[model samples]
Target chain A: MSFALNGRPGVSEATRERILRIAKEMNWRPHSAARALGGARADAVGLVVARPVETIGVEPFFGQLLAGLQAELSAKSIALHLMVVEDTAAEIEVYRRWVSEHRVDAFVVVDLQVKDPRIAVLEELQVPSLILGGPGRHGGLTSVWADDRKAMLSVVEYLAALGHRRIAHLAGMPAFHHTARRMRALRDHAKRLELIDAVSIPTDYSDAQGAAATRTLLARSPRPTAIIYDSDVMAVAGLAVAAEMGVSVPDELSIVSFEDSVLTRIVHPPITALVRDTFALARQAARSVLAAIEDPGSARDLETATPILTVRGSTSPPPGDAIHETV
Target chain B: MSFALNGRPGVSEATRERILRIAKEMNWRPHSAARALGGARADAVGLVVARPVETIGVEPFFGQLLAGLQAELSAKSIALHLMVVEDTAAEIEVYRRWVSEHRVDAFVVVDLQVKDPRIAVLEELQVPSLILGGPGRHGGLTSVWADDRKAMLSVVEYLAALGHRRIAHLAGMPAFHHTARRMRALRDHAKRLELIDAVSIPTDYSDAQGAAATRTLLARSPRPTAIIYDSDVMAVAGLAVAAEMGVSVPDELSIVSFEDSVLTRIVHPPITALVRDTFALARQAARSVLAAIEDPGSARDLETATPILTVRGSTSPPPGDAIHETV
Candidate 1:
């Protein structure tokens, strides 16, 4: 019976088939928790988010990623255990608890930070874990990352081509590795291109912060001809800020968002944005994590497609007088 | 030892304390899976959403509600089992699987439909379930609801008071009970207030649909002076549509969103919105569902505060000559 039910080598094919048919007739299904007690797969993955809950509502990136994860995982009947924590400490504690309880088969970790403590703890646990952001620094864990540096460079090149000499970037949470990479990308390229007055402003990725930073930047003597936001919501808020201060978008100011979503397209002068398929990125992460769970310590780091800059109404050559543009 | 570990009446207080101390020293905590085999609580709640994966990203309401639910549930160390499914059938399958496996202690159901099938399935399964939207039609299950009808009435009353006679409501999916309630509310009052050209346009709650509907409406010889959207994203899309057609907001048109989020507030002309404490509402639902899990069949229907209409820059008396107005 054990052999038949467990589909082990001891069971003959005919007998196993007969037993499975009988079990089906008896309405028998393997209990997920019972299987976990017997050291079987939990058939679930955990995601512990460390962002403030309020930010989750407005940020399209997280939602799209979650949808992609769900779409892929649910196809295999794998449950997603989601928890939003206040900070990294709380997030790590969740990982510890879930690990000790054997509540999840694997974890999908996001929001990778500089010198992230969660990476060390996750490594120590020796559980199948995948980091959603990184080409490096996630020791022995499978990681999937998009090229943040390359994506930023494309944005800068596009803006420079549009004759935007003075540019500003609204970066998210300076402590994040991606944020640092983006800032550094802007700095390096800005120098190489001889773009004067290029500046990066760190923000919490909140609309309030985005608006405040935009207001401060717009008030400067030689304000940026183009402003790049790290997220779509911030770009919208920056557009609002431009309107509030009587700065017409694309005409007086060009705007670009690092991320793209319906929020970018639905605005008055639809924002020019760097478009990556976040859903596909998350789906790849889900597949990588599932592979890690299936073959622990074997899965390798995966790099996804670089975000492509899609130009729309909100970006154009800087106004004729501001930077002397040809096109 | 079992009594002490389980915290049952058979164990003496001193013995239980000593056992717990030793267990703590030994790093012995209850295994969540092991506990489930003994019919102990799963220490988790399930929320299976039945929306297309695409919509989840841009919708602020779901994220905020999730944040609120997490904030309340996690304080007591309960986990949220989240799943996004294609439709109600998939949602029901998830419920069945989770219930059979004892994967969750209770279920928090959202997006209540008129004559919902899940209500019956939940009751039949005898699981502790709470509907997040409903005052009626939920069969013997606990529910938490805000007054949708009252909220709609207030928006219409406010618009009437502002001297807007031509009102068009861009409603959400028509199958939703709340959507029906909102449509009916507008219908009932539009007659009483003698607001001619009042119409309700049902949509799938996508920004694309919102933009299309707005374009169609704006093309009319006598375009609506006021437009109310069921969601903040849709409202933002509508505002963009007005901009494309060169209709000045709150001058040629007034716009209001039934649900307010950062999206509504950060736009060029900040949208007037119906503000409800969605976070608080979700917290209350979490509490109610937890109570239902603790004492099955003991939880009752809970009515939360009605949404209040918040007037911002988006709403005003309809364009001067379009409708006669005072103040």
Candidate 2:
């Protein structure tokens, strides 16, 4: 058993194969509790989602990422144990319990917040983990990420080219690491292009919130001629708000959404969107976590492909008169 | 500790509170495994999703259902342990492991298939469970469900009243019990109305498949004046297909989707849909499973409220010439 499990290469191929077959027939899988206690592989990974339960369903991001993570984990016979918590404090409790009990071999962390404290806990526990966002301030924890700054910069540049001088970004959750990253990029790029009246509104990633933000932004004095949304669901809702308000898209106002979904394409004047495969990025993150588990010292931060802008009917040159008086 | 855990009625309220508070302060939690071995409680419920891994993310049904499930479970301080598997065989294995390991107190099962083998497995194991779909073919498992037939009948009646004689239903996977129910209802209802042309097409619930189905159905001679989709995603995709084909919705054709989503209300000619509170149904199921876990013999099957149809821009009187000719 040791020779087979540890790959000592001492037994003949036929003998090793026969032993493995017998073990399978006998249902002799390693018990996770004992394995965890011995500081050995539990053959399981933990992903704790810290978000309000009611809102978790509508966002496509987590579901897509889970599917991507499963693609790699299942092939290696690793079980993904999922837990949902309402906030950061509860999420921290989950990590502590899992670490103490050796319930999981490693952790796959996501939804990074400002000055994430999970890093310190993970470091103290000597647990193997992979963060799913940013090439930013992680405390030596291996991470796989996409370049959110570059992605945000591309969106701003595209809108600017379309003659959108005054723009408003309706973003989700300002405290999140990626949201902050995108906001910073938008500010920097818009300044570089000499565009004035660039603004952002934080939302809770709901259609209702997005619609409300669109209505409030449009009703303001010197209202922006162009708008960008952080999510497909929000973008779809924002478009509905515009339609209900009788604002003509592209002719009077231009729109862009950050995520590409089927929701984006079905709306009137299909939304111009930033397209990137969440599944692919998640797969890379899973692979990196697996690598770190086996050789913790060798793991390093890796960045996946940046988002690419897909031009569609929703974005065009801003309205001739609307772009001026404000800036 | 024993008195508080078991509710034995032998301890003072103040003493119990103090014990619980100290337990919390010390970061102590019951050992779920030991509790399970004593046939007490694991304080967790298992949800095993057996869907194709690649397609799990795009569908909003599972996500919404999960959110609804969490709302009830979290209130009772029960952990929702989620596992995603690829097939029934693997799902059965999960049930066995969870039952034997005492990892969960009960299960919440969805996506009921014909002659579901899961029923027999759950029966054999004597596991407490709640089926989220039909009150049908369960070997003695409690179930919570809504009337899909009544929902479909309402949709057909509404469209028929709108002067759409020839209609088509673009349904999802035929193996799912609810899909079969909806299909049967469509056939029966349409036959009673004596609609000249009625057809049902099966799809895999992907946007691409939805578009393909729409294209094929529309290319026929004297193509149907109206169509119903099994999901919000499919309906949205179908609408996009109609747009691309330059077919004017509500005039040249009408569309109705079975599930209500932000997708339905945000499209160009917003899709008319059958609306229901999935979150409520899921809550009932969660509560049912919890009750069954406490006292299995007392659990009973429950049927929730039927869907309410929401009229929108997509459904109206069909083209002047086509409606009468089909009749």
Candidate 3:
């Protein structure tokens, strides 16, 4: 039998009370109630990609991460509010609008640089955020990042064992926290291996830049026998450059790269690379972001990713006596 | 100036009357009144990717398209909601919830199958939608599609001009609309050119599937001198298979592929490919979806894309005396 309450037919007092109580508990309003109230903001999650669109599309990392986040959110029936900002300043503005307008429940931060300003902005606004990269060197927010230093060392050691003495690294922007760590690790590992010279070239993490950096490295008086690129796209560019210059891969110029994107596997000679389980990383990041949004106190926790090196055909012994040229 | 309407706050009676009249005329709530009634259902755009997360990450097309959409949406202060579903049924369910719950303003539909069920679902609900591929043989939906038939024919003619008579196609699933169109075009164009023995091998659009398809084609009685693939990743896999089989590219077998992804240019013996401006496609889809939401009547308009052929080093004439054997 249906009961009546609040001057409405077929509505029960107990049911109405329960509904109101749950709405208050969740800080949510019924769609009809919201419509009655008029122009009310909705509960959503905000994702700010702190990179240009052109750059983001060419990189495989963001695509996987976004896919994972979408998978989790779809199950919960939660909405993801995505924004692509050109720089950190623009990112700050987007987040401010989202928070002030009550447009989102949480934020997903990516590509964190050292002394990241977003962390400070998020803290001031008390906005729950989960960072895809580390909490930066200073550290104060929830973060999920792959072990770049260890991953770099693994590749370095692998190349060194292949009898390479002079190795050059084509790294991402110098300001990136992970880039600094990766560079340091490469240098330290090279020293430990008794390599004569270990040089680093900074790049903007694009294929064009990667190719240019590789060209400079190759033009050195005595070229490095092996090169390690910060990204798979760059590695692919390096491969192309090597081919263009008539340098035979794994013979005249061995190459190792990071990211392990599809490009690495598709090249005529598959590149030897460090493959981070980006799918796993994305899943972990999604889980962490959800946790941070649910329990703000958990925002201090950091998740670290371990990278595995997948060897293909890109690396081999240096040509003739060039292995020890720098030494 | 302060204005009073509906027996609340007033400075000028005429101004209040005008404001109320305008609100009624537009069938909308006043901005100030709406702002006061906060926390309602938000306006957002939803993107449903009907593909596995594991595979989506490796594909370059999604990444570029997503970035382009994000770029455009961010300018309009609109949020992009992303969801990844395993199949068509799951994608439809996600859309249903979003529509019934008013979680999104419109949807970006991707990877449409031959007789996509999602189209019917969207139509039944009268939800605004923009398809990323051809609207299929059963039209009645807005779609942004690249001319796959023209693209395929161009590849064939380009290879044929290079004196490649024994051409083969490594295509996507037989059931896919684009794949079917490309396959039909390959057969018809081959027939027109008197290359009666041309072959088309269907694949699942993955590297492994591509490799297997290529192997099967190569084992034919009179192997094809030039192979064309539906995707760049599959093309890469074909290259690997060719290498494993000790076939020299361009000398023994020429290759052409679709999607001028980064891998196309980076691989050794770079692949000649058809390049679709993914950025432009994504932007167009975003615009169409937004337009559909604003004006549902225009949702059935068809948007066509032309694929451009970029020649690299992957094509060459059939090996000496091999053409006669195939004919």
Candidate 4:
């Protein structure tokens, strides 16, 4: 009749048995056990998002991904702890505390940079983590990434088919490992196509930065006829700048962007860009993280999201007048 | 020399003293001792967003608020754990687990509904939480909200000033606390202005839902000349529906929306909508949550944001040919 079991004092056996039986019957075993297990020793998943919140609003990709992760975690009742750090160093400190204190069962690492310090720390601590956006330098950790290289190639091929010879890129930070991969893919695509003077200007993925970068590229001696941006916000900004400068899009210049946010579709001349289902990416990352938590060996699995091109109004063949003028 | 402490069988006093001295110099205190001395806990501040991820993408408000929260939390080395719950009941469960297990120090609650169940749970647990868009039901918990009533009134007055009498509103769920407050305010404003036939349709805040509602209103014997929506996405959907029906914007109908996201500016003939600096709202929420965590008494302090109207190309006077042609 007593609630005590295995020398642990609590409620009556009937109540405890009823609760345990109900939990098992309802498939609430993982979360209930996790909650009963207590902290620094419980089974909760953690996510360390290193990007600032301001950046997240401007960039639609992460918001979608986070949503996907939330959807996956909520169903399993496995808690997803999100920490927003100022920089990579702070992220490392967060991971260190979470791992050493045994506060989290696994980690979801995002925005991996070239020569990331987190890789070493994660490896040394032997903590399980799923990296979203792979750091090509790391071979040991499990990674879930969008195929940026293939996406970039697709973008180039699509633009070339439209006869855009002078294409410029407004890329994200050069220091980012994925940025480097994307840039390499872009250059190779342009080279193979025998295009002259394929240019890339690196910006920090802000609309203003994108606009400013676009302005710089436009001011060149032989102005680029087409511009590509890493994010839709940047592309939107570039569009605004082009509008303000009296440049008619798809007539004087064409524009393409990534992310395919609401902005892309709503803009006057909808941007032709590569689109990835952010929710799918998030779900993938969340599932991968859960799998890693369930079996640490799952950390060896690599998942890549293929980007699809959505053609809208912003792209067209070079203007006949402009082509004749250039000739 | 060992690293032992007072009466503890560990390391020597000399080694311990050196560690303590270095810690003191660096202002780095042990978490356990710091907890006793009222130092910052490593626990994160969690946000349980009750809305779905698909909804988050279309709504710009949450993104801005999260960014603001992130900015504030990052400065204090506190993390923000975000979980998306399917419904209010699920949200309560998430909160319970987070509080009982000390997963987070506090929470920021969003999308408050009338007679919300979370209020009772929060009260029972006495957990520190700040609700965005307050229900006006919970007096004890801290609430940070925009002046929805005033915002609704302002939009009504703005449309009224443009000489539009029949105005329809595409609103969020009627059960939502903000929706009730906004509806009441809109109705009161209409009565005060002596405007006839002001109507409102409650929806789930989705583009498809908004479009369907807009279609119903447009089919009325006397269609509304000015339509105001609770969200930009809804407004965008309404615009699309109008376009499909060959209704010219600002010529036959004027549309105004809430929450000026990038969608507002990018759409053709930019939407004239209610604008608030989401960044500021986010910053304030983050700051308020941290303050509440530090001093639970601060929960009584209510911070309200004022909504500003951004006039774009969507609003104008009623067409001159309508009444005459109908007659």
Question: Which window of ten consecutive residues has the lowest lDDT sum in model 1 chain A?
Answer: A22-31
TM-score of chain B of 1: 0.88
Model 4, residue B99: C-alpha shift (Å): 2.3
Sort the predicted structures by DockQ, highest score first.
Answer: 3, 1, 4, 2
Candidates 2 and 3: which is better by DockQ?
A: 3
Writing each residue's lDDT as its tens digit, candidate 3 over B1-327 gives 122233553324654454344334323322322322342334568887777766777778888888888777777877787777778888888888777656677788877778777878888877678878874653566778877888888888888877777888888887778888899998888767768567888877889899998898888867888899888889988887998888899899998888788877777788899988898888888888778766778866565567899888888888888755544
Stretches of candidate 4 off by over 4 Å are: A1-41, A216-222, A322-327, B1-42, B215-222, B240-246, B322-327
Candidate topping DockQ: 3
Ranking by TM-score: 1, 2, 3, 4
**Residue range with the least summed lDDT across 10 consecutive positions in model 4 chain A:** A26-35
CA shift of A123, model 2, Å: 2.4
Question: Candidate 3, residue A320: CA error in Å?
Answer: 4.8
DockQ for all models: 0.36, 0.24, 0.42, 0.25
Each candidate: what lDDT? 0.84, 0.80, 0.76, 0.74
> What is candidate 2's local distance difference test score?
0.80
What does each candidate score in C-alpha RMSD? Answer: 6.5, 8.3, 6.5, 8.0
Write the residue-wise lDDT of candidate 1 on B159-275 in tens digits. Answer: 888888889999998899999999998998887887976799999999889999999999997888999999988899999989989999988899999998887888878899999
Tens digit of per-residue lDDT, candidate 2, span B134-244:
858666899888888899999998888888788899998888888998999888877788788888899988888989999988888888889999999899988988888
Clashing residue pairs for model 3: A40-B40, A41-B39, A41-B40
Comparing candidate 3 with candidate 4, which one achieves the higher DockQ? 3
Instruction: List iRMS (one decimal) for every candidate.
Output: 7.6, 8.8, 7.8, 10.4
